[model samples]
Target chain A: MNIKNSNIIVLVSSILLVVGFIISIVNTMVLVSPTEHIEGSWKEISWEYEKTESGNTNKKISDAIKTEICKELIIHEAEVWNFLAGGNLELTSNTNNETLSWTMKGRGNILELSHKTNKIEHYNIQILNNDKMVLYFSTDIQAKGIVKMTFEKIKEDSYAQKI
Target chain B: MLRKFSNSRTLKDNIQLGALSAFSAGMVNVTSLIIFFAFTSNVTGHYAILAEEISKGNWYQASVVFAWIFMFFIGNFISNIIIINFNHKNAYAAHSAPLIIEIICLLAVGYYGHFYYRETLSETEIMVGTMLFAMGIQNGLTASISNFSVKTTHLTGLTTDVGILTAMFTKKKYRQNKQLRSKFNVLLAIAAAYLAGGIVAGVIYYEAKFLVFFAVSAVIGFIILYEYYKLKVTKYIRIKRTIKLRKGILETT
Candidate 1:
């Protein structure tokens, strides 16, 4: 090998490596920024239902204490959601809001919020909710993989106001 | 006349043949990648991609990938049959058959791709399959001549070999020094040239896709003519000198 020629190859190789690394970094940063920096929190509710196998009665039935259970479930859910919201919610001032929809792919997320005739799009919102308080959140995932999530709704706070 | 026909001729013949084959491989790789978004030169990367796609349940993309693979196999099969029947060891005649096949395929691409079947089949499928076959034939025919040492199709193995050889050169334990250096240099040249060719191919294909194949055909033609001329001239000069010496001997006698 000619030392000079080999040196040139080495130089080219280093340049290619650096360029590749930089591209990878930029791509990652661009992809991660919106998803990581979304300025919203999810207010959600959780309900747990179970099946029981009994010898005498192998049928579905809501427990006799179902109302209390439901109330506790709702209250627990509200507290958790309120804790998650960190005081960033309005309960008294009701205003018409539109439902937003979005999809997350690879490193990036695309969000679409539709209200009236005008729809606004957000980048990288981890969670969203409609007026009915249904929560929609996204997580970073592979080309295709199981994305883990938790959803719930919080109790109303009288003093809370929308920012 | 007889003395001129010796083993050294074999070395020169193989080098010229190998370089041409390598160039053909490069052209095939470039053209295939540009047209099909697939690589026919080496199936290793393709296989990896296929596996990943399959795992992700990407059946459509996997099918497209396999189309290229099948085309490459077709190219290899066709080239092998042609070479086996005609005895492609002869320099000029050996390259001509494959060159004709490659040109015919390109014309087919222009015809089928442009007007006749453009709407019939997906562009991606046609381009991938056809380019695969082109690279296959190009690789198969030239690979036959080069004893497969010089591959133009891809540089992964070449890069690996170069790395190994370079590392070996640094170690002080090698017994065969001079021979090692020559072999290493040859590997280095093959790899470096392959990368350079890839970069050039990328640039050229952006401007003119068909020119890539035409340029390759020209290069291979040039190599064949070069070897033919060099061998004929050397033989002719040797014969003339031999005749002159015989005449001188007769005069002296």
Candidate 2:
């Protein structure tokens, strides 16, 4: 109602606005949608048995079994998974390159990958963020347990871009 | 189906409403699953996702899921409010309003996805949100009208009920109970219809894509129109009987 009161109100409101904007930016830096978090070149770090039923402590899975596990899977041991915009996924390894499509289901909890041949594979997204994405998939391989796949986000797509 | 109130609804009415609505729900769920990669008819998984997002500190996604959940809640609230407030005035109007809104929502999603869809995050989010709202309206209306006997949105409780009914039928007394048998028949019809709808939609989605929503809308439209036709026929029969009785009284006088 008074001039001084109005001026003080404006000053406080402007300060609040600035503070809110700063917090939003900071939060955005830390937060990302599943799509945004997944849209990059991710190199496969390791493949390990998530759990064993026979109490076998051999959690370490060799890369050889990867082919058997991925037998029905079109992504067979693809070392690098590059998720691009518009549902395009470029999978590559040391030997050859493959292309597929990807979509996130159930609030980004499920990563569904579809090959051009109409073969579909779903991977449960255990933990996904800026730097790391952990995935789990059921395997009927020799060790009948969940297979945990860990992947690290490639900051630069230079290596992936080559293929 | 739309004309009857809760206690007055017969077993036939309940089964008809349950089967058809469940079929449409299944179709919508599968279609949304294929297109948006989200389940629209069911909110249970969405609840889990909301919790996960909140726990993970992804405030944006948490808020998105929160909004989606809220849309569903608000849809149910609005459907129930319409029914409770207007049923005393006009049961048919009260029941039909939510379904009309549902049809509009589905059509909007279909139109947008068919024509203007860019498949962006925001677009997918909004489409899925609208679908969830549509499903909520449908679930609310069926449940409200049927006195909560015919909930067709999700199969979790329905499956549990079917399981319980099957277990009960193992006993001779429960097996002979007419009400239990009719309820079992209704539940089984709904489950079968839902699965059939899902399989049909899944089979057709690859070909029809967004156009399948038009088929869903048609199914809901058929329910509304069929009820209207039945209401008209019943009204006509009652009017004819009343006129004949008046004529007989006049002749006697």
Fnat of candidate 1: 0.00
Residue ranges of candidate 1 with Cα displaced over 4 Å:
A1-163, B1-15, B18-20, B56-60, B88-91, B107-121, B173-176, B245-249
Candidate of highest DockQ: 2
**Model 2 lDDT tens row, B1-253:** 9999889999999999999999999999999888777889988988897787778887766766766776787688789999999999988888989999999999999899899986666677778889999999999999989988899986899999999999999999999999999889888989998998888888888898888898899999989999989988999999999999999999999
TM-score of each: 0.51, 0.80
lDDT tens readout by residue for model 1, B71-128:
6766877886776676535544645566577666665664554455322114445655
lDDT assessment of candidate 1: 0.50
The worst-scoring run of ten residues by lDDT in candidate 1 chain A lies at A139-148
| CAPRI level of candidate 1 | incorrect
Per-residue alpha-carbon lDDT of candidate 2 for residues A1-163, written as tens digits (9 for 90 to 100):
9999999998997576556545543553466778888998898999998887766798888867887787767787688898998789988878888888887765566787888788888888888888899999888788788889999988875664764
Docking class of predicted structure 2: incorrect
User: What C-alpha lDDT, on a 0 to 100 scale, does residue B65 get in candidate 1?
Assistant: 56
Write out the backbone clash pairs for model 2.
none
